[model samples]
Target: MRKVLKADSLFFYFFISLLWMEVIFRVSVMKQSYSFGILISCIFVLSLAFLFFFLCSFFKRKAGFFLSIFLLGLSSFIYASQFIYFKFFRTYYSLYSVSNGGQIVEFWRDIAAFAGKHSILLFLFFAPVLFLIVFGKKMLVFKSCSTVNKLSLACCALFAHGTGIAAVYAGGKAPNSAYDLYFKNSYPQLSVERLGLLTTMRLDLQRLITGWSPDIELAAPRDSKYIPTPAPSDKAKEDPNERETSGKIVEYNTMDIDFTQLAANEKNHQLKEMHQYFEQVQPTAKNEYTGKYKGYNLILITAEGFSPYAIHKGVTPTLYKLVNSGFQFTNFYNPIWGVSTSDGEYVACTGLIPKNGVWSFKQSGKNYLPFVMGNQLQKLDYKTMAFHDHSYTYYGRNISHPNMGYIYKALGNGLDVKKTWPESDLEMMEKTIPEFIHNLPFHTYYMTVSGHMQYSFTGNYIAHKNKNLVQDLPYSEQAKAYIATQVELDRALKYLLDQLEEAGVADKTLIALSPDHYPYGLDMKTINELAGHTVEKNFELFKSTFILYTKGMKPTTVTKPISSLDIIPTISNLLGLEYDSRLLMGQDAFSNASPLVIFLNKSFITDKGKYNAVTNTFITNNGKTAADEYIKRMSAIVEGKFHYSAKILETDYYRKIFSGNQ
Candidate 1:
């Protein structure tokens, strides 16, 4: 009996150790919250209790011990494979292109740093639990299982694992279809076969991963001015037989309009009035620095999950500097992109509206992306590079980054760091800035991860030690915790600015700071607590900050409403890049676009005031009522713009517009 108990203890110890190994593997890959560990532990404990009770009722001790060992080993192996697949190979099969070496290195460094910070606690929590399982009497009863029962249990475990593996493989290979299948099976109430049919037609993940290799045909380059014959004006009044014969006999060709033509069209009366309004509100461009440094380098940082709460008067001085001294956009709005966090990056960088229910960056991998600051500046002989301190391939950014014309780098791909979960923003700045700064005429984009959500002490680094600082903020505990995470983001920004100054390129470098999106997953109560009251459920609540700081530029403010899509044309004009103004859907708010034609669902704002398309109501802040005629005209204009933007993306119209191949 004593010997049997000792053997059982050993088996339990092995089982718990295997479980800890699985947990560590998952944490390294997913960066899941510590709460996941607690949940896993609960599930594991229950499984063990079930096993022990079943074995003790009928089996002998020795047999149970062998059976438990086999189950433990098998489960551990299966869990480990999930981590490996998710961490390394998952992105290769995604629609987005995979990142190269430098990018992966940058991501890995953050993961290492995160692991170092939590390793001690993880070990302490897991070690004793492992020991108790191995030596505890409950484990000894499992050793008594009969051979037949043990084999049956092992087969059941193997079958369950195979099913899980198959499901994961199928889901990864055909995400949309698998998603539809899951919804149909698990949520019949929400599942629609028609919706699935629509989605499945366009969602070809396999084709996206492999890319198109269609046969190429070279043709004479065409210009936008080459217009096709217009349809007869009297077609509506013509006989049906005449129309049918005409349609059958000859195909009608539509004229393709180029960006230049589109811009020219927008130069009409209404747009001219809108452009005038923008010029009146445009801030003065300041060149406070007299000397011309080699050439200006631009650094655009889109911090993930960042919010205005990160900005404090004293706590974050550099941010305060940018907000106060640079060309600060007080009413700049970043509308939530369809995919939320990363999709917002796509919109801001590419100045393209994301497609409904699909990731624009991923889908647009095959489309021509013009006006990307990185791609645009590259034409000026600038060495353009992009950095992300997380997995380089998330959201298919590895592919999209190259398409944006950046030589990309992430934690695991190239840049080395000390931690995981989130690589230190400061470390990314420290390692990558030197490579580009010395080479003058360089533009670098950084996507930061330190401020990501899951605002709890164990899940986030900010809440680990800095809770005391925000404890007195007039917000809920969760809100305060969210704010605390930004401390690291704040510190990283200050460090990057200091490095630029130290490198003597501060004046020549333009730093554009923008949040990827509003931090939305926070509870409404928490958001309301932070806002000091309930926030309006409309578009304004989703608005974010945009700051463009060029060292030694005179501080000015623009209060006119603007979205991130405007950044491209705005910055291009500011930098004096000769991009055709018409090609971009977003006009330089400093150019011909209205102060308000911002599109969300439908166009919400017109020059006259805010218009709710659904309710067909217009409200002016100045208390001036708009005439019925003006509302009708404005709605028509908004609808026209939406139709044009969609056509531009769907038909690949920009290539002809900008390339003079209309």
Candidate 2:
């Protein structure tokens, strides 16, 4: 065997491993990444290898080689696990998500199942490690050089890191530098596309150690007069799906905001930009639909793992009735974000994007969340409460829900439900309804658990309980198992409806329900089967049901490109609550201010078209692509929403605005 550490030999093994990792990263993540992105990823991997090689080279060659093998093997495992995770969950993990890493431990069995399914891909991915271990150990060589050579190596590492950042930064475009590209994009799936997985993880680790904020100048829209307010009605050119203008003037729900004065006195430049931005936000005009359910008792649910597939007339009559007989949102979606359930729940409840890496809801317990249904309704003297069917402390809901102005309770606390793999949603309804059903003007929020995954009867209590319900369907076992879980959710809804009717509050209560996310744990084959065919993975897979109804109400259909993020603002608008439209990342779907559904990856669905940020592709609904300028403009707005949403959370922008938290 050759001496183990020739300078080139060390670099050679390091790079071979690094390059293979990149290929796996690309194949697994950045499959659609542009040629430029692939090139940038290559440079990033090389830089990382150089830095690690130099740092570890200070030790004996034997130690260095061993360390190199260990790290390379570890890298292979990381890439493989991440590949499995992304394959199943359809999202990537970030450093921020690691804080909530406890959640993943609960799904170890599911993770293992997924890993086993993708074993072949993983085997190929790690094949290079075997080569490095066998051929590398025998053929590789290294020798300690003079101080001059050591210093030169040190400089080489520095140059590599520096050059890599600069080159990728240039490619990242403004607002998203290489640092932002790698660390703060909030969309890890996209980050892995541009930066190799190792580079992205390295950046993520840096961010975890030293919290990062996007490096962008505060900007005001070029034309401040372009407020998102409705234009004068033109009946001759009405959209086919739009409610015909009654030849009446539209008015806005005017908040007593003095942005001009606020901006003038604002000393902080960031706050000033926010004030300016809000100043120009076009207030969605109050329409006939506004306050349609004002003063009504409200029961808002963030149903876990819900999808349109959950609604079947024969199997889930309650859901089917509500979906067909209420404000059925045809184009609604619940985009899966970084923290899908927690973040999804946060978005629905707080109308804010869960800041990347932190539980925004749990963190909100420390802030003044003024617009949550529990908080907003409590102001109207409604007895507000929130509940979950899991452990009271799971995801720190005990802290977050109460902060949302609810008298919060869950499995371990006030609510008494049997301890099972997943608790019963119906039992929760049975126990909690009496406490609030008779309390007139009450508002209750539920973060439901019945529809949660591990889509098998054996692993999921709700699925097992309702397995026979979906067994007759000509669907795959996994598909049936997934639907069985939702049947329990359906039964839960049935219990809720019966309680409301018995209490004579069925018509008086406004019920709003949407999923925390689609059933991601289920196989895609099952997903396609449920969808009736293969669906567009990006937009359609995220498409879901948002149920808004009051008993005996006329069914109204909305076709706007709306999302879960828009739920709070939409409900607030419907309930006649005053909020600044500009400050919110999501616009009211009922507003004339253009519907935009933002996704985790910064892609968007608007009324006119869809923009896939990963592929950098714009596909118009009309089949003809829109102007490049239009796409760029839409992309900017999407990017702005992401940047400011995170900023809003980090800075407690709401508290600062209302309560002087600055």
> TM-scores for all candidates?
0.58, 0.90
> lDDT of candidate 2 vs native?
0.77
Q: Give the worst 10-residue stretch by lDDT in candidate 2.
A: 234-243
Once fitted onto the true fold, the runs of candidate 2 whose alpha carbons sit more than 4 angstroms away are: 1-7, 28-34, 61-66, 116-145, 166-184, 215-250, 621-625, 660-662
The most accurate candidate by TM-score is 2
Best lDDT among the predictions, by candidate number: 2
Question: lDDT of each structure?
Answer: 0.55, 0.77
Candidate 1 lDDT tens digits, 1-662: 88855644543454455546545643554333333223333333334434443444354556545554555544443343333323332211122322222233334544465446656644543454444446644644443456675666555445543543344344432212233323311111111121221122223333344442111112111211111111222331132112334455321111222223344556454333322222112121212221222257888888877777667776656677788898778777776643566567877787666543345676566667667888778888999999988776777787788888889988668877665454567677778877787777789998887777656655566566567777777777777777777777777778778878887988888888788877764766677776666886555676667888878888877777778877776766667664544445455655333565454445365445787653457788789887776565555444434444544455555464446531
**Model 1, stretches more than 4 Å misplaced?**
1-295, 465-469, 597-599, 658-662
Error of 2 at 190 (Å): 1.4
Tens digits of per-residue lDDT for model 2 on 1-662?
24434547777677777788678667665547656667777787777677657766676767776777777788787788678667756776765666665567667877777678777778877887778787776776644556776787788877877777777767756333345576346456656766667877876787778877554444336443222234333331132112345665555655556676789999998888877766654556667778878888989999989899888898989889889999989999898877778889999887777677667777777887777788878888999988889989987788888888889989889999999878898889988989888888999999899888788878788888887788899888888888888888889999999888888899989999999998888777889898889988888999999999999999888988789989888888888876665567776778777788888777888777888875678888899967776776666666666777777877787887787422
